[model samples]
Target: MKQSSEASYPISFRKREATTLGDHLRHHNSVVIIGMKRVGISNFLRFFLHHQEVPTTYIRNGAQLLTVIVDLNDLVEREIYPFWVLLLKRIVDTLEQSKVPGELKKAGQRLFTESIQLKDLFFTVDCVQKLLGQLIDHGFYPTVFLLRFDRLSEVITPEFFGNLQRLKDAAQQRLSFIFTSFRPLYELRPDVFSKSSLSVFSRDLYMTPALATDMTTILNTLQSRYNLNLPKAVVENLVSLSGGHVQYLHLALLVAKKLRKQPETREELLELLLKDEEIVLQSEELFASLTKVEQEVILKHHRGLPFSQELQEKGRYLWETGMISSGKKEIIFSPLFENYLHRIDTPVHGGTEFTKKEHLLFSFLKTHEGILCEREDIVSAVWPETAEMGISDWAIDRLVARVRGKLKAQKSSYGITTVITRGYKLVRTS
Candidate 1:
């Protein structure tokens, strides 16, 4: 069923004044953008463009703008000419489609019409440069081309990669490229990418599920924009449950709002939420994206079986998807999905088994079992550097206590022990 009103919950892109992924991409000259292939990077870019009310977004002291998103999925892959043709078409369309001032709009339309008349003119690299130069002539200054390459590995040949570098050089930093890929670029091909090509894409930006740094701002915007009456606690818990995944968080809230009665508990909330068809379909899609090896890794982690260190990237990806979370010691699937995974009476392993922070703490303790880890060391390892100031000794103690309780609840033999004048140690009980 359709969960919520689109107007109520807009695409959840970052606000203008705030530093967003868009802003970061815009301000920086070089960016090799990596994101979950499924999480809709294109959608966010579109939303940002729409929010700016134009194709151009102001950056660096109210100067410079642009985000031209080309979904490679919509275009034929492994071909250069067709890709360029389609790309030029998209840029022209965006300029025509955008609500830019009259001159820019006319310029865009003119580019579109001229390019169409020229037909195969943009088939060559120089021709493509000429086309973009025309846009510059028309005043589309400092435009950032956001190319959404579905399976970048498939499209990116050594020749194609070099071509992209040439395009960047041709545009003279006026054109910055943001390419998306499912797996890491290095994993795709180390040899094909020349040093010059690598240098252009040297600044790698890993796109996580959502911008965790902007969660507070996002939550605040949601509450105000939607006029939601959710208690601060409820809102905070929603953040926790969603793991700051933008879409999942949006879906969860929509489901929460759809419930006939207000949910007094998290279980009640989940029950209401899991009923949404969209949620289930999205969850299935997430699982489907995993390879057998990836699936095994998740299943093993769920069952408390060991996963390889080599799969850290995969694990991190899964965690970003909100399907699983990492504890300091283990990876855990989301309880909502974990419960669904185990219908019969077999015990599910680590999920909701520990908070993310606690998991980090426990993971550290587990790794350092029998060694006394000072509070300072623990804080440094588990918490973000920015958060170190707020995390006091008492805060660490409380977190350790929570970990101890969770361990006991799981009937696990592992526990933490405080050492006088030292720190703490992870111990196993018979």
Candidate 2:
């Protein structure tokens, strides 16, 4: 009899050894002596704060510790005042909705009312600091403010950055903050290039790709849970192809689950990924999430070239995203993706005719070559000036389909395909 999914996989896989940051954040400390002491005090304080009636279960999930998170990428524009205003509103709303102790709820409500009354940046900053102070005084010590951003180099503006600095300075010691970005922090904010700045942002933790052991554990856990009757060799192949990238590994498993028949051999898995157009097309959605520089990093790493030391942060971001592994390796994290890229380009037999739109689309595809092109990217490139005029995905798809027909008729080998979740890429089946 097949074992239950919950029984086979268990929650242990989900709770697999937490990342260093996770551990630190979860315990408000680390395994180190200093961290332990700090955490002990924090825990003691928390224990005292929890009255018998106040349900402690709310804070048990490590969610309460993270008071606020601002995702820079989600903002349409980097307006500091509005962003903070929105964040403050969210905090107030969440607190209002939460079943916290009466005192805490009242304090949160008062802050919300006071925050709404503040109209100027100067007052906003002061009020935020004051509210944080009040929270600490009321035994809500160590309120962690989390700032999460991707591609900070591009997203961060001078005005927005100043606000962050101000908050860091104002909340020092009383509140703890964690700033996370795909790239290194020092590279984004100015004047932090010095050794002193490094000290200010101490405890730099890098999350490398998963190790072999991690992959094995994940695969075994997934296999038993899903009742995927994959052979040992096929499982080994899946690991080998994933390059220990957690994201790609998960994707491969999902693909395996979607297959009608369980693959018994490595070659079958590869065939299911590469030869299957439907499965490969699903990758377009995944491609859409990558920035242009990130896409380049993946392609360059695939081609066995090292990006500049200056570009190392970009590489680190890609590595963190599970697209590529570190070291002198040319391996992409996804075998299916690697195969898809390899089989993208085929030989063009002769001169191919093109429409005005087709010409532009074809040229763009050629420029990008093996790189994944997002739907929006194609829109911007093909209709740069008319982007505001609104180029829909359907328009791009229809244009590409027409172009594909022409390429086939003209006996050209180059093809453009949709990577379902990602976007599109030009493949030449040589």
Q: Residue 288 of model 1: what lDDT?
A: 54
Instruction: Compose the digit string of candidate 1's lDDT tens values, residues 136-194.
Output: 55555445444555334544567766666676676666666666555445655666765
lDDT of each: 0.58, 0.54
**Against the true structure, whose lDDT is highest?**
1
Models, CA RMSD each: 18.9, 12.1
* Cα TM-score of candidate 1: 0.58
What's the lDDT of the predicted structure labeled candidate 2?
A: 0.54
Candidate 1 deviant stretches above 4 angstroms: 1-28, 37-63, 71-82, 93-111, 117-127, 134-141, 151-159, 186-196, 210-234, 308-334, 337-430
